[model samples]
Target: MATYLITGATGGIGEAICRRLAPLHSLILVARDQAKLDALALTLGGSHHAWATDMGQDGAIDAFTARMESEQVTLDGVVLMPPQPHADDNPMPTPDVWRHLFQVSFIGPLALLKGAVARMNPDPAEGRRAKIVIISGISSAQVLSHYATANVIRTAWVGEAKTLAFALGSRGIHVNTLSLGGTLSPWYRDKLEERAQKNGISFQAQLTIETDNVPLRKYGEPAEVAIVVEGLLSQFSDHMTGLNILHDGGFTRAY
Candidate 1:
């Protein structure tokens, strides 16, 4: 089985991806909480390994590579699910907000991708061409009411992925971004509930209003996200590269 590294392992979408991939492949679960990563590794019931490191801080990617080198582990693919912006990441963002967002969302994650791919491709022993799937939000491609930090940082990642795809295509590496819309994760649920309270409406009403613009009129589930990740890392890579595939249930209106 191929070994894939999944960053942000304990988050809603990350955990779902792990569960979906575990049956067919080995995993390297990455997150800041060693304890949580260990617990998740156990639940998946496999020969999975866990690596805990804060991808937001400086030198974090270097340290992760050091550990991987010591273990002589090479990756066949990656599923990068960087942290979403916090509540303070508003439109007129502060300096601190921008710094934190850039460090965690953009620099750190892309650094890890570079490091991981360095150990992959150009080696015949590594087998199939490597795949890199970056998980992001539709806000980067389309305007949202808020999410200023997400808009800027995720858009940068989209561009970076395309650039990387161009540089790595000849090396048998595929780089792409999965732009997501609303999903029924805990975080989104809380946001919907909060909006519902402010508008004096039921949670269902809030959810419907939120998804009204989506052609499917629905929010995606974490499991569905996992399925898409699996495809991109497998069949879809044969001829596709550098594309930011949208998983928004028709929520995006822009071209």
Candidate 2:
């Protein structure tokens, strides 16, 4: 069985992807929270394993690579799912914060993909191609002022994925990013509640206003996002590389 490496596997979308993929493939779940990872591993079945690592920390990629090597793990695919949202009263976008966001959104994914792509052995005997899937935000296009750092960093990640797709296509490695819109996950619900409280509006009122803005008139479910991720990782999407698949329910106006 092919092994898939997933970062930020404790978060909403990430956890959804893990649950969706774990039954079919062996999963290596990476996150900072060991307890959460362990719990998720047990719930997802015994085929899933957890690796505790802070993806935001320096040298983390190298350390993770070493661990995988020691365990004789060769990854056939990777899912990059690092978190990027900031609640109220967090630090502003200073140079240090920008650097950290860029590293998490851009640098870290690149490093993980580099390692996974290097280790992938897509022989005819293996019967599968290697893939790299990144979970980014719609802010790459929508210039949300509150998420300026995410806008800048996710754009960079998209650009980098394009280049890597071209560079690795000849080796049968696919690279693509999924730009997500509003998904009704626990983290998003918490964020909405927090924003509503700050704005002096009821949570239902806030949802009503936001849904009115969406062309689909609803927030996407975590399973919807998971379906998109699965499609990107599937053989049917092998011909597609370096593309950004937007899952925003037609909320973005830009062509």
Candidate 3:
């Protein structure tokens, strides 16, 4: 069975991915909450290890990679799900906020991916080329003035992943980013609830407006996104790389 590392493993979409792949893949769950990770590991009923570390902290990614190295864990794939940026109406947040978001979302994932690439590409005989799936927001391509950090850094990450895809191809590693939008997860539920309360509109009303904008006319489920992640991690996508896939229910029309 292939082994995969999933960062932000306790989040809504992360949890769904774990559930979807638990039967097939060996997972290394990384999250900020030890209790939640432990609970998930138990629920998954597999030989999985849970690592609790704050990605926002300096050297945290390095420490996790080192631990995996010391334990002689070879990963076949990695799914990076950074902390979701809270929607801030500000077009530009304070410099400190931007820095914090960049560190937590972009820099930390870059460090983890760098470390994993070294370990995952040591030998061609071990398995298929290492697969990397970066779960980023739709703001990576679409303009979201409110989510400044996500709009900027996540977009940068798409370019970064494309570069890595080319650089790592000869080493048998593939990299791709998933630009997701309007998924029906806990994170969005809370954000929508807050917006509804603030606007004095019903939650369903707000949801309708958002969903109506999409060609699908509905919000995507976490499981729907998980299926795409599974494909990226599997041999089904061996020929695909350097792709910034839009999982936005036809919300983004850019060609």
Choose the strongest candidate by lDDT: 1
Clashes of 2: 0
For model 1 the local lDDT of residue 145 reads 65
Q: How close is every model to the real structure, measured as TM-score?
A: 0.93, 0.90, 0.92
What's the lDDT for all of these models?
A: 0.86, 0.81, 0.86
Model 2 Cα RMSD, Å? 2.6
Can you write out model 3's per-residue Cα lDDT over 83-197, one digit (the tens) per residue?
Answer: 7566766766799987887888778778877777767843546656789999988898889767766688788889999998999887778889999888888978998899999
lDDT of 1 by residue, 176-214 (tens): 899998888778788889999999999999888988888
TM-score for candidate 3, please give it: 0.92
Q: Tens-digit lDDT track for model 2 on 78-120? A: 8887567553224365778767776766677667667667677
Model 3, CA-based lDDT = 0.86
Off by over 4 Å in 2: 87-92, 124-127, 195-202
